[model samples]
Target: MPSLGADMEDGTLTDWMVAVGDSVSRGDIVAVVETQKGAIEIECFEAGPVTDLIAREGDVVPVGAPLAVIGEADASDPNRTEIQAPPADPTPEPVTSRPQDPPVPSVPEAHEPTPIGTADASMSDAAPQQIRQSAEEPKASPAARMRARDLGIDLTGISGTGPGGVIVIADVEHALEDVTPARPLRHQKDAMRQAIAAAMVRSKQTIPHFYLSHTMDAQPAIDHVTRLNADRPPSERILPGAVFLRATALAARDCPDLNGHDNGEGFVRADAVNVGLAIALRGGGLVAPAVMEAAELSLAETMAAMRDLVARARTSRLRSREMTAGTITLSSLGENGADAMAGVIFAPQVAMVGLGAPHKRPWVVDGTVQPRTVVTMTLSVDHRANDGRKASQFIAAFETHLNRPDAL
Candidate 1:
């Protein structure tokens, strides 16, 4: 139960990707926890052999609870305790005919306990036999499960190609090719909406928010994208949204006040501008996963990252870090969105930049009126962390970057 977001206090351990004795490296997906948002792949932060599984599937654990224990490679210690095997059943029957104590399973020397999720260590473990017996609900990646559900395909029939016989998204797609498409299943959008509502309510109640809106001339960015896309293929062409994102990232970099998290005690500025892109899910929910280190990425790179993030978010393939690493957020309405819109400040983040649909408008230019593309940019800021002056400066810097799209 990693803290996927501020609103997440606990999560249900939906699946396990690794078992005891399995070697895991940093960044490996060890388990999947279902938060209110959705199923999130929990990555391993330590490297070594897994010595214990503390949280079993279907166990609801809170954030920072120890979900497993990892051990060092060396196992020469004489006093080392043997690894405790997962329980065969949640409640085992009492045995009256036992003659002696059962032998404990030997394992490598254990290191510090690694906190993965919140659960009582005494809780019943998911035994290996139990894991195998539950073949009707086969092991699959979060993306695979979502895809299978959407396609109305049973995971029990498909063979897994992923490590430890875990079904992946590719396998689901391959299965789909052999059969007709079924009606897509409805997602748990109600739960997601409730989560969003709770977070927004908390944000409003805790943070003093002030909003500022600026309408900028978008003709330069629009023209620049057009010229750049003319020679490129459709797949490689950049959209105006990318330009806006890049501009926001750069502006955030220059204006420190607008680009960091708000700790309860004080403000902590972030070194890298990780811009969280607010993407609406297909069924009717939203997720904002960051394009990590966006300030350092090129315009094309930013566009690619945004596309990838959106695609992964829709399929419930987002990692734990992506869900929690946003320092500043950007919400865009794209070309078909409303002319102007304001967004709520995502808790802990100091600022949120909103981009409205770009459209043609009459503007005075050099003593004469001219029809030009214009976009309304709104900034919602935490007043405790920044005032109106700082917000205006950030907006001004953003406009400067947006106007000079060639430099992005």
Candidate 2:
């Protein structure tokens, strides 16, 4: 179990997509773990054959716990473990008189306390259970078994259609339709809240932050997006959010102070602008997954990426790498939202940029006062890494990008 976030110390293994002896490659999703953020598919970082499975589905264990061990690929090992047929018997033996040894069970070996969920298939006592299961006990995960037990549903007759002919949680959920509609659980929300609180407290204690706010003319960017989307389909239409993100990434070229992290030694600038967008989850929490290499993408590409990121974040389907790789964060209040927003800095990354809803405001243009569309942009930076002068340059560069919306 990998630590999905700073506050997540443990997670529950919900499902295993691969089985013992299965070949796995790098980036293959091996299992799904239920953390405070909900079910996240865990990817394998190595390429090998699965030799041992130490954690079973629905087992809650601390971070860094071994879920499975992938063994080096070797043809000889399979041959060595292969069973051979018994030599021909000289005389016919009576089946009733011959005694048979039970199949050896493969129990999970753990350094920590055993999780109270389903035991691995290898860990099961095969003999007695095999005899009893002749009535066709489906190969179901521990969580599915627990659900069946709780729901008073029989698994013997239901045909399993999961990987390797196993029964999964979805099978149990399908059974749930006959009884009651399954709503999202509440405990996950509470856990997410606690995790957010812990992270915020840590950030506030360690990072010395300073704030800067500027009111930018929003009409130019708004008109640019409006005209660009005028002919495009609804799905491909651009939004003001994309313009803000693009401008931030482009502005970092002139003022790189906002695009880096502090590793206690000193400030280290990132090679690329990976902007993290603060997205709110419907369940009640916030996650800022990155738009990797945001500076390299086009305005339309950024909008598409933002849409996908927000969708995945809300669905609790984000990947491990996406969760940990943000350089700087961007938070925005939508239309009808607050006039301005000042946000806390997510640590390691020294800065956070926020945008408020655009509204008509009085502005003097060429010594004449007139109503203009404007938006407040606020930046939060770490005092240890950069000074106010650099921050001002960044904001100026950002405003210039917004003004030249056609170039964005």
Candidate 3:
């Protein structure tokens, strides 16, 4: 099973997409595994015909365990040789232990396609194991297998859309959408809660955390977005969250300390700004998927990616790249959430920025009372990587971005 997250250990192999004799290529979605984070599509790194399927469906295996063996394709074929073999070995003398003038590469053995678990047919117990293995191997990825299990859909009958006929999570989901035993929301939520607990425990136990809070006026940002959207279609309208994400990313330029991971040895700064957006899932869980290179994207591009990320995250459609792409995190509570939020730092990441719901409040501007849209922004920093002074400056830069929303 592949490690879906830093916290993942053992994952249950839910299905196999390729059968024993099927040919597979590198980058194929091979199997589906169920991790605590969610069902993830496991891609194959080796390309060849499958000789053995070692991992059984619904079996929980540790990370790095072999799921299947990819056999060499016609190893004995002359066309497979890269360098030409010299002619005239016909006059060769008797074999001796002494080394030759120039060493020759050894010829590899030829292999015919074998059934699942029958690659080594000489083993005494091969027949019984082979029968069981052949009955269970269907060539699906771990995530696809888990989804099949959850939805009570049989993998043996479904066709895979992934490379090399490997069934992926999407294929299983489409099957489930048409027919299923029951929705497994409660069970999934419980599993997600456990995963969150383990991660938070690890985060607080090791990382030295400190807090910073600041309140800023939100009128400029709100007005800027409203004016920009006035002439555009409803689909192109920008949300307030996009402004917050872009501003936080821009602040990283001046405060580089807030934008990387601390992997025990030392801090390794990231060259790009992939800001993870903390989204609350509808099934009573949360996931933070990154918006790749947030600082470099225009306001419209950021909003478009944010919309796509949130939609995929909630529906369990996130890819491996998005899940592991975070350099730093940004979280917010929209209109109904708390006035201010104090967030815990995700481990390895040096900082997290949280935004509270923006509300209208009375403010004294030039000796006159005026209603202004204001929001409370909180910055959670890792004390080992940065101090309160730098944290203050980072927040100040963030506020500055919010004040000039046109530049964002």
Best prediction by TM-score: 1
Error of 3 at 122 (Å): 44
Q: List RMSD in Å for every model shown.
A: 13.8, 15.8, 16.0
By TM-score, how accurate is candidate 1?
0.71
Clashing pairs in 2: 106-122, 106-123
My TM-score estimates for the predictions, one after another, are 0.71, 0.70, 0.67
- Candidate 1's C-alpha runs over 4 A off are 73-187
Task: List candidate 3 segments past 4 Å from native.
Answer: 15-32, 42-59, 66-184
User: Global CA lDDT of candidate 3, please?
Assistant: 0.68
- Clash count for candidate 2 is 2
In candidate 2, how many Å is residue 80 off? 19
The prediction achieving the highest lDDT against the true structure is 1
**Each model's total of backbone clashes:** 3, 2, 17
